[model samples]
Target: MTVRVLIADDSSLQRSGWRMVLESQPDLEIVGEAGDGARVLAIVRREPTDVVLMDVHMPRVNGLVASERILTDAAVRELGAPPRIVLATALELDDHLAEAARAGVFAVIHKDTDPESLFDIVRAAASAVDGRAD
Candidate 1:
């Protein structure tokens, strides 16, 4: 099955880059894209995607806040399960990382993360969605 992906990032360049990288894989699908966290939940709800590759910092709302909203929202909750949430942050592991962890987001991948590491993240997020560890 294709792993449907929703790309949420403020940078147009980074969104394009992420699309190129994730959609290059045969098993992944670019379901939708959002430029800011404000648009995120609405898009996700509209499509009911499988995974969210989210950038932590964005205008209006941020990934961490948006993620929390998505996971706890009644609609997504009633769907039987929430999507896998993987944080793609440029920031280092600080209190935010722990907050994300506590929020039960699947994985936290740095923006400068190597090509090889992306696969590991994708795999882990997929596994987490499959009812495995986050």
Candidate 2:
């Protein structure tokens, strides 16, 4: 099955770069893109997203908070299964790792992670949501 993905980052360049990498894969599809956590929330609520690759810091709302909201929102939870969220950060992630896990994030990776690794993580997240072993 094609994995529907949403890319959320504040930088236009970052979003574009991720889009290019993800779209090159046959099983992955870029269903939506967002510049901040609030837009991410909106898109997740409206779209049938399987995985969310989100930046840790964003304007309006941050990735962890948006993740928490998505995990706990009754309306969102009722929509079959919630999309798997993978957090990405340019800075040190040590302090946020526990909180991200608490918010139901599937995984966290540094923004500088290589494209192949990024693809692996996203595909793994999608597989987890689908209850399939990767």
Candidate 3:
């Protein structure tokens, strides 16, 4: 099954870069895109996507806050398996990193992660979504 993905980043280049990497995998599908954290919720609401690659720094909400909101939302929380989120951060801020764990993130992927690792991370996250992982 294809894992539906949403990309949220302030930079167009970063978004496009991730799209290219993720879409290259036949098992991953690019379902939606957003350039600001302010727009992420709406996109996810409309798309019913299974995964989100969110940037930690953005114009409005930022990835940490967005991830918290998604995890707490009754709609997502009530699901047997909710959309897995892997925040993309330029800097691995310890605060945001710890917060990500508390926010129930499936993973935190670096913005500069190598293509092979990115693919591996996404696949592992999908396994988490399916209750086959920790």
Candidate 4:
């Protein structure tokens, strides 16, 4: 099955870079793109997304807060298996990682992660949407 992915990042360059990498995978499809957490939710609401690649640092709302909202929202929860969240961060902060885990993020991807690893992460996260992977 093809994985529908939403990209949430403030930097256009970063988002475009990720789009290129993810697009190279035959089973992955980019469903939406958002510049901030607020936009992320908006796009997810309108699109059928299986996974979200969210940047931790955003303008309107941070990824952690967005993740918490997405996880706890009743309407969003009703959408079958909730979309898997893979947080993207430029810094490797333990506190952020802890908060991400508590927020129910599926995975944490460093900005410097190799393209192959990014693809692998998203592939695994796609499976997570069905509760098939941990």
Candidate 5:
């Protein structure tokens, strides 16, 4: 099955980079793109997204806040299960990880990490949503 993905980041270049990596996988589909937390929320609300790769730091709302909202929104939950959100950022702070956990983030990855690892994480997130292993 194909996994519909949404890329959320403030930098166009960052979004483009992630798009390139994700597009290389046949089972991953780029459903939409968002530049900020509010946009991420909007896209998730209307799109059939299976996974969301969102930047931890965004201009408008930020990933942590958006993630918490997405994970808890009744409207989104009614769509079945909310999409798995992966927090992507250059920072590797433990505080970020803790915040992500509180907000229900599936995983946290560095922006400069290996493409293969990123692919693996994305696949795992998708698989987890469907109760499978990657």
Candidate 6:
């Protein structure tokens, strides 16, 4: 099955880069892209996404806040299983790790993570959603 994915980041370049990398994978599908957390929320509410790669800092709402909201919102929950969220940041993740876990984030990775690792992370997150490693 194709894993539907959403890419959320404030930078257009970052979003584009991730899109390019993710699109190259046959099992991964880029459902949408968002420049901010609010857009992420909106898209997930309307689209069926298996994984979300979200940036830590964004205008309007941050990744942690968006993760919390998406995991808890009744409308979102009604859409079936909530998407697994993976928070990515340029800064140290130590401070945000606890809070991100509390918000039901699937994982956290640094912005400099290798492309292969990023692909693995996203696939793992998608697997967690449906109990299928593929």
Question: What are the runs in model 6 whose C-alpha is more than 4 Å off?
Answer: none
Candidate 1 lands at a TM-score of 0.89
lDDT of 6 by residue, 1-134 (tens): 78899999999999999999999999999999999999999999999999999999999999999999998888777788899999999999897899999999999999888889999999899999857666
Local accuracy of candidate 5 as per-residue lDDT tens digits, 1-134: 88889999999999999999989989899999999999988888888788999999999899999999998888777776789999988876575998899888999888887889988888889888847555
In the range 1-134, model 1's lDDT, one tens digit per residue, is 66778899999999999889887788888889998877888887777677888899999999999898998888776655688888888878574778898777888888878766886677667766748553
- Cα-based TM-score, every candidate: 0.89, 0.94, 0.88, 0.93, 0.94, 0.96
Please give, for residues 22-63, the per-residue lDDT of candidate 3 as tens digits: 999899999889988668876765566778888888887988
Q: Which lDDT values do the candidates have, in the order given?
A: 0.82, 0.90, 0.81, 0.87, 0.89, 0.93
lDDT of 2 by residue, 6-71 (tens): 999999999999999999999999989999999988888888888999999999999999999877
Instruction: List the pairs of residues colliding in candidate 5.
Output: none
Q: Which sequence of candidate numbers ranks them by lDDT, best first? A: 6, 2, 5, 4, 1, 3
Query: lDDT tens string, model 4, 1-134?
Result: 89989999999999999999899988899998999998888777667789999999999899999998887776676666678899988897665888999999988878889999988888898887867753
Off by over 4 Å in 3: 75-80, 93-95, 130-134
Q: Flag the better candidate by TM-score, 3 or 6.
A: 6
Measured by lDDT, the strongest candidate is: 6
lDDT of 3: 0.81
Top TM-score prediction, candidate number:
6
Candidate 1 wrongly placed segments (more than 4 Å): 130-134
Clashing pairs in 1: none
Each prediction's RMSD over C-alphas, in Å, is 2.2, 1.2, 2.3, 1.7, 1.3, 1.0
